[model samples]
Target: MSLSLFDEPKLDSHCHVLDPARFPYAPDVAYRPAGQEQGTLAQYLQVMDAYGIRQSLLVGPNSGYGLDNRCLLDALQQHPDRFRGIAVVRNDTPREELQRLREAGVVGVAFNATLLGTEFYANTDPLLRHLADLDMFVQVQVEHDQLVALRPLLERNGARILIDHCGRPAPGGGLDQPGFQALLALARTGRTAVKLSGYQKFSTQPPPHADAQVFVRALLDAFTLDACFWASDWPFLKAPHRLDMGPLIRQVEQLLPDPADRARLWWETPRRWLGF
Candidate 1:
């Protein structure tokens, strides 16, 4: 408990680099992250430096770039050692492209059933299986009971699963909520992990995020400290209100008061997962 986490070397498991000025948003994309939602690499690095974050796992945001991962790839290529990425690829993406992305420092691909809906990804089994074959993670973001239908697809072909934002459970949904339960059941797969980050995304309360504490505890019990990692979801795209990285970091302290648990959650696990 004496640890000063502010200086701890940690890996941000979920974040994005949106440099629209240099990278440009996809014209056909449905949404563009203007204003505070957009974060250039320079700004993010400043935040990272402030927090002593040694590295980050950047996810391609579906908002600004859609299926275009150029922005994500550029950041990875520019700082290969400091960043690894999860790209957003079409379900029909070719194996060669996946390989190319892998070589460029993409360890995985993201599926946003939370935004695009479950039916949009109904026939993604082949892609999912291929990603599994490639040893790349299938990072998923789903809410409510959306995970129930996709659980089987994740299980198929022994895919490496990484659930985002603590499954973004419905407020007051309780620990037994089917989607959250399904997320917990995924722990037995061994190939699965969860990011114990982004309470602001799902929590009904402000900072302390009291309602999410029980779920975080359950995840620690089920997925254990190793498979459950930390993320800031920095720049906090599409956030409902104002957010800041410094406060979220302190919130982790409140959630995992044990310094040992904080050490593992913030540093050891993500470093191991990303092979840093």
Candidate 2:
């Protein structure tokens, strides 16, 4: 039998499980995710089942939790078979702690240069080296011209890297923009991968995000199908408007019309990279 779009097996390469009630938001955070921005593990699982997602790569957000990875760890421990995680940690965090996180099902650490700015991660070389030694990924979220500043640091470490949100390209920044071009250039490095997601974060147009398609095509051509993965930035943090998973799934169908290509981007690539 042929499969429907939602019925096709998928691994959500990006999403979050925020249980402020159980884990509590950090006191120092400038903004706390409330209401729909929050999606607990139980809730996320229901969404997964609803959408035919086999697993998810849970990312720890810096907004409400800061360095507190307890919520993410709790979810990973509780549902070890269903999810892996990307964490948020301080630059000075010790190797021992990273090892502990690795043992706990964390696959990488996130560097949110978009939310915190490139300057904040200037001292991350040691951390990057630690990740390289550990064979873990350095997942980055940077926007606009920010990537130009961090390219040297990211390339030198040789840690396997995952980029978030199509580099969160700056609005009207076209194909030749320095930051997006920098992202495409990373494709030559062979150790890099990008989450083909977050159109709402970067696109000037809504939903179908027609303008962002060019960037997607450029990335697919640059990184090749094997190195690209599909992601829905679920319960999308700091979003300017409400969004739903259904439309995102439909968007993927439109993005890659061929069943064979969708199979690679949606399931095969992530399964190989994350061992799902």
Candidate 3:
């Protein structure tokens, strides 16, 4: 379809929703947002509608709720057409449980290296096998530097590897950072896909996050258009300030001047990578 930002039916490859009442937040969660009226599914959908985002992938918010995926799964099941989910499960989680998740519209499993540790990533044989059996990707949220150390292991395993938040390079480090360089090399292999998202997560500057382009451009230059996905990281929970969706959407369009590139970023790549 030939379209611009206002008309294109897009897919937000990453976002979150939390309902503390239905699914209690884990006490051991690393951090908690102060407000209860944070991003809920209904609020996120409103943003999606405003942006013409036809579909979204609800990433399991492990930070606030540990491994509990009920909140994410419920949204997936309740709104199958508009959303899919990535669940957070321990390496030892039962196969039957995974099978159930698959049936419930969970397209992948997420690993938070920032919290789960290198050991969790190191022991991937079983997890990879299970994910392969389910035809799902392994989504990793890791420090940019870890991309170098994690590359060989992720590549050796043969399952699809999705890197979160533009490989999360040091703010302004761009291609010079060793980890980002490793990420670029990984992209060339075609087994890896990086999310064009979380601008707020890694940016040191204020709103609009224009400086993040140094990394964004490097990703588009290194990876095939189909290997890069776009996301809102909606609700922007950890950000220093709340963000509006319009500017980010415009930023993506500006970064990808050609409609073909925007198509891949907004829909094609995420569709292929997430089984949408």
Candidate 4:
């Protein structure tokens, strides 16, 4: 396999893996992945090896498993050096359980406000504080508009915040949009890190995602390189078109051609944030 040419160790900061045959979807699964081929841990490792990715953050497929983290925990246990996890957990989940997840190599907990609503946070404030106390990252997946309102609340309760999918910015909003601007401001605080990921999820244009570059540049200018991270959002779940990991990796290189910038985006930032 041809390894990455970049100087620093690479990490895909966001990806999900699941095998429905072994770990079936929750009864109330919000949505099922459209693809016939679900991502498996073994499959992800094959790609990681080919691309020279030294580590990865395996985010729980929340829609598939609900609050159950067995799939993600298993991956971490089997390959502790190569993987860390972000699990989906409920408000009432006990402290002992959270500690168990931490021992199992889960470094963060994810909440999908787009599906769960803001009240989810209201109910989970205690859990959020517990996560913060444990020094674990709090991952929030919400649309651009939610940032303005959510930022203050998160600042007060969350230890560190990871905004998923580039804040799910609206097309053509660019830097002027209040929500996007708020997201950039949050990044300026250094406590909030934005995943330079899920381009296909937010872009109006197709892959290689040229349209999203303008906003990304603005984020780099505002957030600084250390607060930004790059990820594959692999298996391309729910994306409009199929995307291969090779092109996605190349896209970051094209976006940040300077070796130093590429190293930060692909390695340093994620390594620090995810504790890899």
Candidate 5:
């Protein structure tokens, strides 16, 4: 049987598109690419079409692009029908600039603390309040341990949170660890969601790491399908080893085997959360 592109409605809840030629990595950054490279919207669209994805949430890449969301914003404009974006901005980014981004279809502001450090947004209530006023969700990429430190502030502001990569908890730490526990507690409030992606980054084992599965299953059980999202975490940033996106998708398929559950993770949930 031929595989049809529209086998299901798919919304890739996370990924990045960068144009290296236009925006090269800063030399001062801790990690630099081994080689000059570029990945574009056209390249990602082909992957999406092949994988039956109708839409995607394009996040700004941290390693190379820093706070410049131009490449990501440009992609969203080019394929407004198929892409929505989340951007990374400094805490002091102007309100008018943010409004312009909102007009360009950015639904959330990403705090890539995992790569840039949690202190980047520390004590920046003015910025947080601005985002809240704009009604934009805050997508955080902090390590699981960092969640505990952030909980009170997040709760106080009633910020809608999207925790990236299953909170990036230590694989050996287990669910009882403060970070995972904090995440579970946050989920209960109905104000937070977690992305079941980038498990490989936290595990030493191979793809579909059993250690990672423990966390993935726990998140699936904690968050309603509406509060959960999944992604390939394509190009698998800073992995100790390489990973193929195909197997990653299959792993998500395995985790969500029921058709309705699959539909929620693959489509509905992301549409509701990301507003794409």
Candidate 6:
């Protein structure tokens, strides 16, 4: 079936849209996009329309606008129907400011540990507790190994956790690897969700690599459609090759061949997790 038919309820659970003119990237920021002007809310909406995406969650870009969510928040206000936001904040940020961000349609808090380093939120128990109190989800961008290391702390917090990029498991490691095992264990607790995006970022091989497929299928099987979400990871940051969001969405359709599974991955699950 064509993705157009899924128009009414489709959602991209993770994406980054920024107006570089307003929030330009820092010179030293790692993984900076080739040209800052490639993606914007307007461009993102066009892609969404083409692929029948009704709504999307705008995740804070780690490279630019570090802890300054105004750019994303503004986009959310301007296109409330088509977007929601997840923000990255300093562990020491005032509670009042965080509360204000929540009022601004910020549904979740993100820790970009892969780029910022794991110690960035090391003493973040209080922040995690605050999110739990607000009933907000916690988004983590750590590789599989890091995930395995942090599994205990994440499970103990009891806050809903969203893992980025298929756990970013090594290409040869397979799903039974220690990191993936930890992710599967977290899924069993019914408090975690994973994004089936950025396969390019995880694999050394090019598109349609069988190793990448192995990891994707493992996640789909381990978490079930209800606990999974899909994204374009649009603009494909720092990727060696350019990726079209449209084809990625189509790839997801192929991966989850069951109509019911597609419905859950593309529609039902996002609505529940992103509250759209």
Q: Go through the candidates in order and give each one's C-alpha lDDT.
A: 0.88, 0.90, 0.81, 0.81, 0.78, 0.78
- By TM-score, is 2 or 5 better? 2
Model 5 misplacement above 4 A: 1-6, 26-28, 34-38
| Alpha-carbon RMSD, each predicted model | 1.5, 1.0, 2.1, 2.2, 2.2, 2.1
Residue 240, candidate 3: Cα error in Å is 1.9
Best by TM-score: 2
- Kindly indicate the candidate among 1 and 3 with the higher TM-score: 1
List model 4 lDDT by residue over 1-276, tens digit each: 533464346888889987777777788887777564378888899988877688998999776788878888889999999999999987787878888899899988897877776766776767878888888888888776777777777777866888888888887776788778778778656678888888887788888888988878887887788888888888777888778888887787788878778888888888988887
**TM-score-best of 4 and 5:** 4
Model 4: lDDT of residue 111: 76
Candidate 3's C-alpha runs over 4 A off are: 1-4
Q: How many clashes show up in model 2? A: 0
Candidate 2 clashes between residue pairs 3 or more apart in a chain or in different chains: none
Residues 1-276, model 6: lDDT tens digits: 553444535788888886777667656555455574248778888888878788888999876667667779888899877787899888876667778888888888898777776766678887777777777878988875778767777777777899988888876777778887888788888878999887876787887545688888888888988898988787666777757765676686678667677788888998888777
lDDT of 3 by residue, 123-187 (tens): 76778777767777789887758777777777776777788899888886767889888888887
Q: What is the C-alpha local distance difference test score of candidate 3?
A: 0.81
Encode model 2's per-residue lDDT on 165-247: one tens digit a residue.
89988888788999999999999998999999998888888767888888888899999889998999888988876689999
Worst 10 residues of 5 by lDDT: 29-38
Q: After superposition, how far is residue 90 of candidate 1 from its true place, in Å?
A: 1.0
Candidate 6 TM-score over all chains jointly? 0.92
Candidate 3 at residue 68, lDDT? 83
* Candidate 2 displacement at residue 183 in angstroms: 0.6
* Model 1 Cα lDDT, one tens digit per residue, 21-129: 9988999888899988889999999999999788999999999999899899889988999999999998999889888889899999999998899888889888887
Which ranges of candidate 6 are over 4 A from the true structure? 1-9, 26-28
TM-score, predicted candidate 1 vs. hidden true structure: 0.96
